[model samples]
Target: MWGRTARRRCPRGLRRGREALLVLLALLALAGLGSVLRARHGAGARAADPGPPRTPRLGRREPVLPRPPVPANALGARGEAVRLQLQGEELRLQEESVRLHQINIYLSDRISLHRRLPERWNPLCKEKKYDYDNLPRTSVIIAFYNEAWSTLLRTVYSVLETSPDILLEEVILVDDYSDREHLKERLANELSGLPKVRLIRANKREGLVRARLLGASAARGDVLTFLDCHCECHEGWLEPLLQRIHEEESAVVCPVIDVIDWNTFEYLGNSGEPQIGGFDWRLVFTWHTVPERERIRMRSPVDVIRSPTMAGGLFAVSKKYFEYLGSYDTGMEVWGGENLEFSFRIWQCGGVLETHPCSHVGHVFPKQAPYSRNKALANSVRAAEVWMDEFKELYYHRNPHARLEPFGDVTERKQLRAKLQCKDFKWFLETVYPELHVPEDRPGFFGMLQNQGLKDYCFDYNPPDENQIVGHQVILYVCHGMGHNQFFEYTSQKEIRYNTHQPEGCIAVEAGMDILIMHLCEETAPENQKFILQEDGSLFHEQSKKCVQAARKESSDSFVPLLRDCTNSDHQKWFFKERML
Candidate 1:
């Protein structure tokens, strides 16, 4: 009975234990199922409950940092200080290896950004149009004077070959009295068939200055371009000049002048790069290269630069401004000095001159000068003297060896100045165009007389009062005490001697010296005072006391006449100093 009771209890205990284990297992399974259901539900909620797409936390947002305030003056001291500070910090940061590694990473990221960005926004890419139709229209004027037939024909053909038809309007050839008969007959016969080509011949010689003026007067186009009779037009030559003129009405444009060897008739090309022609105080032409900074800054070849002066051989200008500036100083003598005169006047009177790189022409440099009916050298010298009078002192300073006595007449120039009411050279320098480089005032002695121990002393004197001399004058002095040989000896002995001894005058001063004063006249007799010096070292009665003193002094070798107190007398009377050729 006891064994049976024990067995029953054990069985009951075992059943209870099994029931508890089953309950624990069921709870574990329910917990697992609930976790799976919650995970699925969370995923469903994430998919269905989206209002706005959430940015990934990895790369979407960056922490904000305040930017430095901009300085009031971008290029001022404050801005410069800020820039220096930043640069210093950057240098400091770059010095550390770890920081440099981080910078490398950042730079790699920046490079990736650049690669992925749109090409249209990229700054480094260049877009250019290769077509010629987009260029501006140009009218070319060729002035011929006994030009070689082959060369003239080649020039026309070269124009046709190089210049686009749309850009070219008219090629007017102004014949300035060509001696060659075939040039007229053949040029008409050959070029007449071409479009927009016309020839105008002057029965008499009009020279280069007037010839160009005549052609320009007849120009129907907005821009008037001048070219020599013998020239080879380069590729894409016309557009640059026309483009510049279109942009600026007052722009005077020139082409790159390459040298054509006269002996070989071959194009020497350029030495290396384009050079703008310049001028000296003497009104002589020179050439120098364009600066590199200028090349980088200019958007096109049309940009204006500080040209020393225009090339004058090939240039284009607007018709309106040309007329307004009175069209090339009509009073200028023949060809030579006209270009310089025109250049100085244009620059001084408000005009910008530039040499365009895009336009190029080859000029034939002659081994010998071409024959001219109008004494070309003398005519040029005359023009230079008349137009560049103010600059003469500076010129003689630089070229001390040059002989400059025989230039041209200024009578016509005087007439023009009166007619135009033109401003004085000083006014032109200070007001009309201050940017132009006018040479500084230089005062010195020049010529053979200065070398012979005689001082050609002349000082530029401003009037004490408002009254100043306008033209020029020379005071003639006849020293009654000395002859020519004695005068020469005295001048040789003394450091300062009178330059002129031919009984005519003192150095030529500007026209304002009016009051005549005689000083230290030994002669008291009125009839004896007025005398003339004979060739055989003698004196004869003339009229004035000053004349007598001059003649008597010229006759003797021992006496030296001194100029003293300013007075109005026959001895101080001045005559116009005429320059002998």
Candidate 2:
């Protein structure tokens, strides 16, 4: 229900090559976090306030990257000697460990937010100049939960430096109750100089979902652009997205996300091809290659590609349409299923979602999310209940115990759906996302293994204990409720395979051996590898004639399972329940 508008730049003394905006951009950007820290540290000794916070001149001068401050507990002399002794492998591991701790980013946040990246415009886009003078004004919202200071400020810098101020209304920063000492009032004070930047602090911990909703409520722009706290907006990123929306107001547009290497802080732009979003039956979103049909129809790389789903971190939506379409499921607790729900809602509610290949933004995809996933599961359930219709069974089939998980009240969401008169999930599947593999929802037992007797512990294949060799002992650790390491799938092939992305490996043992080992599953498992799940929920190995039981020596605390004679003991009694991702 929207149309494209071809506009040109405003006549107001706007300089070429983004030069005229440097002075204004400098004032509107935060002082380096390193500068702020040094000022605070020298406050007792220095006479006056650190002479007018360090200003960032976006286009006028190159910005210097900041280094991480050495920890107070650092071991000095002995550490240096240990490093020398390490020579090779030990040193590598130590460096890798330190890097991993900072969410697998560079040894430090050393990249300038305003640093120029390779221009990613297709020839079609670069050759055509549009009138952006009347494009919809946008408000970029970023919500963070205990994020690193430098990275957060850099994200803000990237936007101001790359975007034309006329189209950008403001940038809203929402702190989701971060406990970091430096992220306190100081962060607000530092950001105060940036006229276009507004900082909001939460009184209590609200996860990313609620925090973003709060940000959206405070936004005043015609379009709301959501950027992750660690992203860098490349040159010309904003124009294409807004231009697409200008063409069609109801169209939700997202940038082609480039990779910012987790370890090297390198910028990896598009590989000259486009990608789309998809999800598995588990409701987990993943990036996949564009389908062959889509490639054949929209042959040009520059053509706008309609996406079935979003990867959840970044996108721009029309403020009016976002509200009319139902902003977000407030009942959804945290950040897991919101993107998928929004994608389905957009397609089902008569709006279209597209990814503009011309827009490029670099996002830091952390190896693991920082928050607890318990709420994510609850959130996914809410989406399934409100919008999935009968198709929700596929989700439940993958996460069987989700039926027992409690999601908050969905009556309001369901009513909202009815009020909007949205299309069903089936229509979305048949039309928008036919490539998604639908699960059969066949009933069976799968997930985490729990020892009925030792309720305090669960079966864990954690490293050193289980990652060592074929016969490495698996231990029982206190239940963490996260099945990431403990999850297993009981296949029709009669093999117990770990429920990771690639679950080709299964639990098995040799004919005469009592020790269980992780091995690649065969189409037809041998008698020793086969296991029968009795109606009583106990596994009986046909070859060994014994029940898999967790047995501990009297003198040791080690609770490792083994092939013990069937005594029907509590240790031998086990049950399977789905684990939250």
Best lDDT goes to which candidate? Answer: 2
Error of 2 at 48 (Å): 65
Query: What digit string (tens of lDDT, one per residue) describes model 1 on residues 41-120?
Result: 77553333225876533211111111233344432212011122335666454334124221122112111110110111
Report the alpha-carbon TM-score of model 2 versus the true structure: 0.64
lDDT of 2: 0.72
Cα lDDT, model 2, residue 26: 75
TM-score of each: 0.49, 0.64
Q: RMSD of model 2, in Å?
A: 16.3
Q: lDDT of all predictions, in order shown?
A: 0.48, 0.72
Q: What is the lDDT of residue 331 in candidate 1?
A: 51
Summarize candidate 2's per-residue lDDT along 1-581 as a digit string, tens digits: 21111112221122243465776577644555545665668754444344677654232111212223444334221111112244478657646744544444333243343455556557677764656556788899999988877668878877877777667888999999999887897898888877589998889988888899899999999999999998877777888898888777678898999877555556677647678887766677767778788888785878779899998879998898788777888777757888888888887777778898889898867756656667878888888888899988656755666788988788988887777677889888888888764433234556577888877667777445322324444567776655556756676767676534322356787767776777655657777778887777677887788888877746898777788888767878887766545
Q: What does the lDDT read for residue 553 in candidate 2?
A: 43
